[model samples]
Target: MTRLWNDPADFADEMIDGFVAANTRSVQRVPGGVIRRDAVPEGQVAVVIGGGSGHYPAFGGLVGPGLAHGAAMGNLFASPSAQQIHAVAAAAHAGGGVFFSYGNYAGDVLNFDAAQDRLRREGIDCATVVVTDDVASAPADQASLRRGIAGDLIVFRIAAAAAEAGAPLAEVARVAARANARTRSLGVAFTGCTLPGAAAPLFTVPERRMAVGLGIHGEPGIDETDIPSADALAEQLVARLLAEIPDGASAAGGRVVPVLNGLGSLKYEEMFVVYRRIARALEEAGIDIVDPHVGEYCTSFDMAGVSLTLFWLDDELAALWDTPVDTPAYRRGAITRLTDAARNASGDGRATASAASVDSTPDADDASRRVARTVLRAVQEMSRTIDTHVDELGRMDAVAGDGDHGIGMQRGAHAALRAAAEAVDAGAGAATTLAQAADAWSDRAGGTSGALWGVILAAIAAELGDTGTPDAAAVARGVHGAAEGVVAYGKAEIGDKTMVDALVPFAYALTEGTATRPLADAWIAAAATAGAAASATADLLPRRGRARTHGAHSLGTPDPGAHSLALIVTAVGSVLAAPEEES
Candidate 1:
């Protein structure tokens, strides 16, 4: 039972503010996150690390000399928006390039990739290395699918060290990938973590039992068993990590760096007790131990858990690991601190983009503007529907995926509704109105669903031109276009137990129904098909994304993305069904 927080929604922001204030000598607050107080070299490749806010010391604390140049802080347990990522990357960029690194969660992947794309378009070089070092998330053969955990420290350290040593962007990225490949981590949780202001834990372990392979964001473990003694727990952790040695790491002479990490509430003495056995286990196996770490490096709010990470080292990596580092949390070999005059000479290297904001009001015809108002109403109705069902959606996701879908949908829908009303005020047509809404939703949501929704709206808006009032056929074409675009972009088939399952049927139903029925009637009929398809997903197992590894656990629950889509589409259909005179 964790306590002490202001408004739950504002927790991440408040935490970041205080973090920067306390570490003013190490970091300065940038627009999206914190950056090193002193600027980087003219040609130094900037390494930017990021993740959700709860994992302190991991993201923000590591931003200083010999580590990350900046950290993109997102909402608690949520990935940063693409806009936020881009802003930080731009601010941290030096003459060489910018390198992005983070855990390989679905939301982080989507948003980071999008930001990388955006950066490239603006002529700033950017590359990404996703850390997938959690042994519990996937089988050894499928290591790419594993989620990153406490092992992020290894990857981020190596990457930043590579950059600090005058390595180019490619070298920095390569070293990061190598570190990720050689790293492996497994964790056990005595209890699940409750999000701020949430009534209950995201997932729970039974009394006298422990959950193995739990995620940082309170995602339930893949396996559960009776709790073990500290010695037995160390054995379990060591054996699991050693079982899957990376290529060329099986030799007795290979060096290894062991990190015993405590999630929020665990005591330091408890960690030392566990590390005692861990050290013996490694020594018995003839693996040379490097700078062994035992403390909280990454945390999951208030969860009582710990993870063991082993980073198999090569000569180059071994040398790099010993480099001096001075930061808010961790420190290594003594390094000369910048003089006050020198530090004051270098200011925060921030880059701002000037956005064009012009009133396009009066350009849209009266009829189109009226329809925009109707779309705004529909957006509001969809938001209300999502607000009513947030808890249910979250429950569906906690079964397998990180349990943040409900909160994510609520954020996206609210942002979209606000953007839609503003677009209406700007005298935007159906196309421009929806385009603005989609951008806002994706920007605020910052997840797989948000990414998908953004693409869907972009495709739909392309079909509905601003010049003409979009008729039933035009809207139907947009619907089908959206379906094709989503499938093409997300690469999920109908049977994959994603939102595609509902979307494909709804797309077909809308096209067929609109051929003869009124627009509102067709929308209602299509929404019904989506709703039924969403319900039917309870019988199907997830075959994509994070839930794929925990399929059995999620078997009885419908895909939350699909279910939320059904609810929103149905709600929006009702708004469309009302008499035109109502608008």
Candidate 2:
């Protein structure tokens, strides 16, 4: 369990600060994350890698000489926002290009892709290689759908090695892709991890039982069985991975890099014992083990579990794998010391300041300002509602997914509320206020819910311009737009057991009701519809997100996303029904 923290919300940022302070010789703090302290050669592709925080020696700790040039560390168990990713990439860019790589989680993919697009638009050539190597998450035929776990270390290393060798961004990306394709991982858990400030573990295995095929985000495993001895466990993992060797890779005579990764709390001695059996098992299968790693590469905070990753190495990959690495946490081979003069050649490793823009907001009309105040009130109510139901929501999510949904929603709502209040105090219009709130929510929360809420609010803000008070029809259009925008951005359908199940029906009902009823009445009806739809999601299986990995474990539970959406919309409806105060 997580025992130390000033505040749960500030944990990630505070941890990064301490990490950079301790490793000042190797890394320097940037706005979004950390970058190398030393200089880079001109026209060398910068290899930037990252994901949610809490995974030590990965993401941030890997930022140094032969590893990642920079890491865009996000909130614990949440992907970095597009803005955060872009900032790290921009700071890391050394005139050649930027190569990005990370675990293939949904939020990570969305945010990283957005950052890649933005960098390209700014004429900074960028490429990405998403690591999808957890064979337990998906079948062989659907390997692309697998979540990246410990296998991502192999991809990050190969990509960074190619970059250090002065390969172009395209070449770096190609090698990273090849590495990901050849990597296979399977994880099991003896227990679960607790997030900072959480009262208990996210999920737990019964006494004497072991969870197989668990994710790194504190998600419960897909299957459970009686705990086995070290040798038996090693055999099970080796056999599973050996059975699903990547296409074109033969087990016999295959040169593989076997990484025995401890999730978090597992002791080094325990992992070494497990790896001993793993090594014997691989040798018996006629495989040549090269640089076998036995330690924590990626981890779920304090999870008493381990994962095995086999990176089938071709000639090119084998050579790349042999490259020297000297990160804060991971070091390999001998590295020549860089002189202080050479290390400071890049001049503090900070990105150049861009031209400043005007920071003033245009004063809104009387009607729009009044509407903005009402928007602030609605956001306030939503925040309060989330705070009230946060624990319940976390419990629902813990049934099949990582139990951070409640806290994530709470962070986003409170962040949005703060932004909305600030905008209202500045006499901003409804559109500008809501837009600012959306950005804050997304940036602060840094998760799937955060991104979707940003999309939803921004879409509505677009319909509610700064000029006048929006009528019922206009509000309905805004709600409809938000629904469509969420669908497009999240790529979740009505029956996917996500928030879409509630959002779509609510949008439709609001659109229909507003045609004949007042805005408050229409919203009330829509909120009720959303509540029912959210409840009905219990009957559906999750077809998307991390919960899908657990399958039947979530059968009787309502999706936390769906339930939170319903709660917020219902709270907003009550605000709409309240009597208007004087402007």
Candidate 3:
């Protein structure tokens, strides 16, 4: 039931047939099952890449003007036969000779080596490069034994560029080998993927858990753990990659390019969230990120996971990366540098802290301090509530989720409030206090909501720190900061039925002259809108987040997490707007 295939025995042949049919203009199927295509400047050096059928666009699909000149496509999760590889080598050779490249799988090695020997016997000059980039697959002493993941793209591209530039077969192979040596990859999978026509998945994963370092063919992962938030997940992946890269590997004189890739079926929003974290993590680690690529460069048949690839560049490989290459699936030389421009345009070429800008002038009513106190009190109260309802929340989540919401929220809120109180008592400035509080909450809570809430509090405090007031303009700016923080951290948009549903409208409302209106009025409007948006989620299938797995069952139940956020925001507004006498 998991895989749909009419004839299991002929699935491999049928898949190849379809591939050739679709790519007829670009690729030709030769005898022995090798697919050959034309690269730029034919008769120059030849770049060949090959792998199993399951990883489409990898070996075969990459054969084009800017990619591989030929590919020996194999069966699903199986290596191509030696004869198939030899046939492709013969068909692709254009006098300059051929450079063979593929992943470092056992079968691939056996077959490619045999094919290389046969080619040499025929008086053809040939070389080989095996890609082994998965750091989790093996230790540094045995990096060659690790499996290749998304990082294969970097290797393939480097080889193709070198070959297209008329490098000899030996030099082309050297470039690819160098890239493979510098490259490293790691991945985490939340679910297993089923091969076509198979009734069961290739592997198994526990409900609500994830497997780190899962192979493309559903191979066993290196480690298993609870599913983490996108930020945590990205951090874990990037940290592992950083540790693997040699010291000074990403320095100014060094070459480092980052690639954020999805396993399969991961939404673009989620991918973007992962990229945001990876970028931040790399920057913090003093790794200069260059030539970043983000997308589904590699896949595992709808597996819900992501991988990170780091290519430590040298001068030669960097030149190849900068080379122009265009293909149906991959493109280089046209990527815009908008991120750098946007960053520089924002004043100091650095991300502005929302609180730092607002801390200059205190509000006439001292509303900033009062609101901070109120927020702390609310978090404290919510912590107690969460402790009381932990069992109930766990039971509710258990019906369809991981059952950690209650505990996560309680821990996160408690940490935030405790940190805030301590900062205040220690005479820490508002912005510093909020940042500390946010960090504490995020460290303790450890979930999606924890990160989001931490970002929100930090942004609010940063904005207040800049102006030290609660004027109309300041409130608007604070709302903007909060919204941006939520988006930056959560990557949820206006209609994803996330906390954004409430927070966005509230922020927009403040932008309209309604900022001077009582905080309760604005909060009520925002909460009501959010509640409506949350209710609307009943009609939409969950697209992102923990609720995605339930499918239709997720419909008709207001997202509990979003509902909780609405309640908290409304409570804060009410407290802030209340008259002194009422308090």
Candidate 4:
């Protein structure tokens, strides 16, 4: 699709115009597209940084009260020219002098060094610090040649705080250099992103694969492999960074601050999943994390990936890193309640529980149950039919997802059936049997869909228990409850093109059809609606879920989960519609 930019040549100028226009009170464009604001107190030393655009909040977004004084912006993924860098330095320099900071990219080095030379010749004291933190960018012996990633934020904050405290220009540079020494980062990408107005991605990873160590600007990665689970990815990243740190010393003394940054297009939820794993890994390694930040601090437009940054801290730099700083992109030192000891203890315990809780009894009914049961049965039947071809349903999931779906579902279903049969053998009603089934399903299937499905079945059983009898209206209520459960658990809605796309419509159809027809008739109509809804998903671009990484490739492929839901509904209808003697 075409972008709002008039052309590639005008893209940078247009972007800067919009940036300054929107941030008039906070920033202004100096000559050469450098963005600056008058330093907060006006007399403190000034920090200036310059780099290519795209890595927002780095060179430009960091310019503020406790960060940078000026930022020179360049064309997308291209370093700002030497002239531009010089202009930003001159604008930010106070009588105390200017401290220039930038990532270690060849273009940035050549240009910023030239600007530094020019500034010194003109009698303006200028100092420069290059960030080299990306472990995957170079071997240990060639650490100085590594590319910078999110650690730039930590280094910039330290330098800016020194400048804000009215430190000498040389001192500010020293603090920045020290911060850079303690920081390390690594990144992985599932897919590349497009430039504005571009027809195709700047780079590409193979379908259903991930490229690790990818540069933000679309540089080739270390290697491409089948997409790993969040836990696996986090383990890999944290291990590499930990190895980069000196033995027996925290990069931040005994404390560490982590930044889990999304490259772009990765959802906040997915990032948190990665964070959970990283936190566990760090804790295992005896690293104390004083604070953690996770978000899209840097981006390649719409790329589906993320990076991890770790900052080791000394008392002085840590104090500066914690200093009150506010900018459009970031905020620190906001007075949140001091974490209570009990609460902190509980919080740590909760992570363990979350990991262990997968085997617990399913919660009350929600939309997910109704939808999950329908999808589960359908997937089970599909597996039966495809069983001769392959041994497991996970293989089917592997066709489109992480390949755990088949094993997870089979295990959950087997658990559910066993639980149900035991309950039934104990003279329990269908409701009790179903509830037991739900608990078993949840306990066996531990990932996202597993918990969701478990909640759904248990909820349906609970609703049935409350009513004491099963009929058309009761079935309708059960379906409604199932839909609610899924929504509550997954938090996905219709157009996100998740299972909700089919479930929501099917639930509505069940309620309407049951009100006007027999139970079997209602189920048939609901199944038809569900099938249509599942088919309709083919036209939608997935806004969430693993499918999002595939972008346009995801379009025209019925969401497997949704399709499975339709199949389950159809199967249940057949069972309910059977002859009385046969039933």
Best by lDDT: 2
Top TM-score hit = 2
Q: Candidate 1, clashing residue pairs?
A: none
Off by more than 4 A, model 1: 347-362, 580-583
TM-score of each: 0.95, 0.97, 0.56, 0.56
Residue 256 in model 4: lDDT: 89
Query: Between the candidate structures 1 and 4, which one is better when assessed by lDDT?
Result: 1
Candidate 2 vs 4: which has more lDDT: 2
Sort by lDDT, best first: what order?
2, 1, 4, 3
What count of clashes does model 2 give? 0
lDDT head-to-head 2 vs 3, winner: 2
Q: What are the lDDT scores of the predictions, listed in order?
A: 0.86, 0.90, 0.67, 0.69
lDDT of 4 by residue, 248-314 (tens): 3553327888899998789999999999999989988887887799998877767889999988877
TM-score of 2: 0.97
Model 3 Cα shift for residue 429 (angstroms): 92
Candidate 4 runs further than 4 Å off: 1-3, 34-36, 39-43, 251-253, 334-583
Native-to-model Cα distance after best TM-score fit, residue 71 in candidate 4, in Å: 0.3
